[model samples]
Target: MGDAPTQQVPGLGDVVGYLDSPTAVCGQRLSVHLSSTVGPTRVRLRALRIGDYQGRGSRLVWQSGAVTARQQHEVEPAGPDRVITERWPVATTIAVDVSWPPGMYLIEIAPLAGGQPSFIPLVVRTSGAHSPYLVVASDLTWLAYNRYGGRSLYFGPGSNHTQSVANRSYVASTDRPVDASGQRTVFKMTLPLVRFLARHGISYDITTDSSLDATPAQLVGQTTVLIDGHSEYWTKRMYDAAVQARDGGTNFAFLGANEIYWQGRIERDARERPTALTVYRQAGLDRLARADPATTTVQWRHAPLLRDPAALVGVGMSVVGVHGAYVVNTAPAWLLAGTNLHKGSVLDLAFGNEVDAQEPPGPHSPANLQVILHGTAMAAGRTKPSLVTAAYYNAPSGAGVFAAGTTYWLCELDSTCPGGPTPRATSGALEQITLNLLRAFAVPRAGRLHPSAATPYESPAWLAKRLPVGGAATGEGQ
Candidate 1:
């Protein structure tokens, strides 16, 4: 309110643009400018509400002035532009700073004196300036016991012997807080990572349970990728959506183990909340045939895609267990840049440490696949093959398709084994390889920066030549 200002601080257009910016980081500061015809007696800044639009309904995420005694809120004055910079404490700022998962959110800014609130529509993204908009599809229908059947890590109260195995493993807990309001734990670990990345700058979207049918066209705004996390079961629409995204220049990261093994259908209630229905079996090949005949199968043995020939020596489909101990492997590669490992060293086990091995190429294998990491036989002896494969196939749209072999291993980047330990030699190598693949197809703004000089391993131009004609090797499941 200085010198007959031409603009008002709480003008509708100003607030609209501030909220409309495509990029906004949580810890970053936002300065709002205002003007007034005459200097008001006094001025103050406060958050009004955080809201969103879903279908035809409006939802409120937060309200203003509803602070607890322990929460703190304050306002600061900016320069003569009559700008009032509102400073919200980190903890209490959740109302203003909070990101609405992967969905759409509508934020409103209102004048304390009761003027109409300005609406800003925002899509919270994950980190990375050019990071792809990652959509995490978690199939909760088939919650594997333990981490891939070793000690029931994802199921319940239990323990593992190996340090690497235990550290990266997720044990089903009766006490651990469940995600999405105690409905599932898979979302719990995954959602936090999503939020963390979004707060840092990465853009992402999420579809869970029955929301899997959100469609590939709906995800058009996304540029780079899609993620399949520990997705044991998937509905037909979900599968189609992933396929469409991949063909449309949207790369993929399979961050879970034994993905696409089972087929699921969505059962929605009146409110549209989804409940997943699924079927599982010891023999994935048979199960796949029963579920979806069009699905392809993976080749666990003697396949050009596998990176390490030793790991698949005995294990397949399911893993019995894994030891999380560091071993010597390629370190100068780009993926290991920031990692402290040099030569023979140890790192944390990422996932599927000890698992029930099943036949190689267990089920639903895609064409033009590549194997990045191969699981080595542990002391328990590698019995069956646990194949972690990646493939590039030609979709109906004429674009190539890239599909991962194993899902769980990809998620191990920040996870620990169930034994409260470190990764063994072979598993550690797998973790590094997984990181490389994700980074390659991630947002693609810049290659991952390493503190020290690192060599880039570019994808081979003749990859198409290496792939089998007509598609992947058929009927070679182990």
Candidate 2:
């Protein structure tokens, strides 16, 4: 919406590809499947650590120039009853080396002709004692909503763009490219935070949503686990592992909202790798539930399971989208360490459309969960006062769990929103809080997670907290 494109910077045509695996442990073999819009494509493949776009920028780590892609798009019908299947013959495979550090790496392939750059992302995981935090990507959620070729589970075939499902079945394949805009959570939500992490010299390992589903035990021995940006979908194993990690003293930080809200599982590719994410609409998922109850593919908090996400994340899904200022509800909370946000200071549009909250956290919820900050957004179409939340709770094992409770938490880090660029105070406030979070989390302790430490209230605190258009000197919303 600004002078530059917010995501999936497209060039001459579309250069697309997928990784052989969603993640790789250091010293393991990882493959990049490359394809292009033009024939016999020649491009430069460069690896960059996601960093501050508005400041230091994502820095290139390793690069190999003059790589060629020779694959052509191929389609095979899965039709005895299915619609279609799209596959690209392998163009080129790049073997990852042990020299690459453990972190989230974005492989950017740009045509020598200088066209739009296509990116393939993968987490370089490490189970060793070196790295402190594990940054997990929501690849499952990315694959869940990807509508590449117009065949997303939510939509019908590309030819029928009416948003109706009558024409297509409820399955999406990982064989296809990610939606043209790139993985929304990664590019827009997670990457910014990753960039923030890199800029600040935070040492962490990176893994994806699929990796968690495949082997959640990989979480053992980590100081903290970060599930940042739109981690809305999950497999039972992924959720359980994070819980187990928490129970075992591994801290869990949920930097974005709507995490673990849906239930889904992985379906293997032809090569027998778990590449596809399978989720059915409620009715379709109900049919599967009849066959195998454990594999039921539906919303987590509803029928058959009734497994509410709030139990793990400290908040549950309520509103899908809201646009408003984020008001500080707790001035004394340890999370607000450096920002100096008082009861009324606001972060302009810090809480985006989707947010999580207590529908009244039931008995199963963690007894120590505390409200960190309370906010209200510009409602899309609701009559009630909009409420967004930030939460924290500690486990007896010394592990602490945090929920930012809004998907827009990372998107606001750069002081830019869909409404246009916001005030510096907003960016400064959000960034400082995040820095405090990273610094606090890197330690083996949870900072300021106190159940009995909450203070008195400030009603409709938005009036006292908002940062005005030109940047305010009131030491409030920035």
Candidate 3:
């Protein structure tokens, strides 16, 4: 190329940055290494702000904005070349000192040299009584959701006519706060849940789509495991991190559903504009196979070939639509320990409310696997295979993998009508079963513990007695 076009080039976002130390103990000194292009004149590091995206009406606003500690630095001179490095001390106030709960944070950097500000999404994690550290990585692209701002992975504008019309007329109701109970977006539900956990003295960390590369060393200080609401996306790095943590004695629990299906590879332009993130689906299995066969394989999909196939339900694919009626088939597994169900007969325990036109099942179905619930399968209208639910245990690492058949079931616990606010006939029993399994998996064999403490929260017998009974509703059992 003769010469590159001169324009207002954007710098890297929050997720792309270096840190002085990868791990930090409680109340210790930590420094973050930040680099950016030196455009023409001196590029000065301005203020850093942290906030969450809120508001409605097509545009999002950062509801909370607070300035971080100030850092002033200059670029190193190198023969008309442009690039600078700066280090800022991270004390307790800036989130390195105190025990930062597990979760993702959006870090934004403003430049004084006049350009669009850059953001770096950081994933901070801690293991049980160990050190906590930050990990920098690229954002996972193509993962779909209802309210996270990008295109809906499953239910989009054209996915359903009624939904498309409603979305157009959808307005954020000021009467109800974004964090209110009946909110629509997964993030809305997740934010409050995080608040609830913090109030109850639960320690945790958050990793976002960008910082999916957070290593096991950064998560060794956490005790309880937590996955945010409707976290349906995953990359090879994310899968490896979680698997390693679980195998190494870290307690784990997925608060959401349909996780680790669509894989993405992070891509950044020379200007770090985040040009495009590529998605990869397996051969004969992508959503667009009907449109083009040559585009379905890993090479065309652009995502790293996932080595661990068990991490997904439909052989590393997405679960589309809802139509089946999921009942609590078994009420006696370790997942349902406290929920004392005597024998047979559990009902109305379906997860993932929004139903899509389902499709065929995957080829590698586990025969010996116990069916927790049963329901009708829908025809995959325009999407790929319809994965109802699946579970697998990695032989070598012994890490248990559970994939909800549908994405709507991601929020099986949210109390609401239609799906029902309170637990259904066997919903409580099912919840207890899940809790039991998680607890069992968390504790080591030598130090295993019960699903619940001294007195369990809800008894299985009590739940069975309170089960709801009636004829099936319209979409009860598709």
User: Rank order by lDDT, top first?
Assistant: 2, 3, 1
For model 1, residues 102-203, the per-residue Cα lDDT tens digits are 343334444445444443323343333233545553534323222221222222223544653333222121111112222122322233234333333444
Give the alpha carbon lDDT tens digit for every residue of 39-79 in model 2: 77788777765655456456566777687876566554364
- Over 175-195, each residue of candidate 3 has an lDDT whose tens digit, in order, gives 100111112332222433333
Q: Which candidate is the best by TM-score?
A: 2
Error of 2 at 191 (Å): 0.6
TM-score of the candidate numbered 2? 0.85
RMSD over all Cα atoms, model 3: 14.1
lDDT of each: 0.34, 0.65, 0.35
Q: How many clashes in each candidate?
A: 86, 13, 43
What TM-scores do the predictions have?
Answer: 0.44, 0.85, 0.49
Among all windows of 10 consecutive residues in model 1, the one with the lowest summed lDDT is 1-10
**Which has the higher lDDT value, candidate number 2 or candidate number 3?**
2
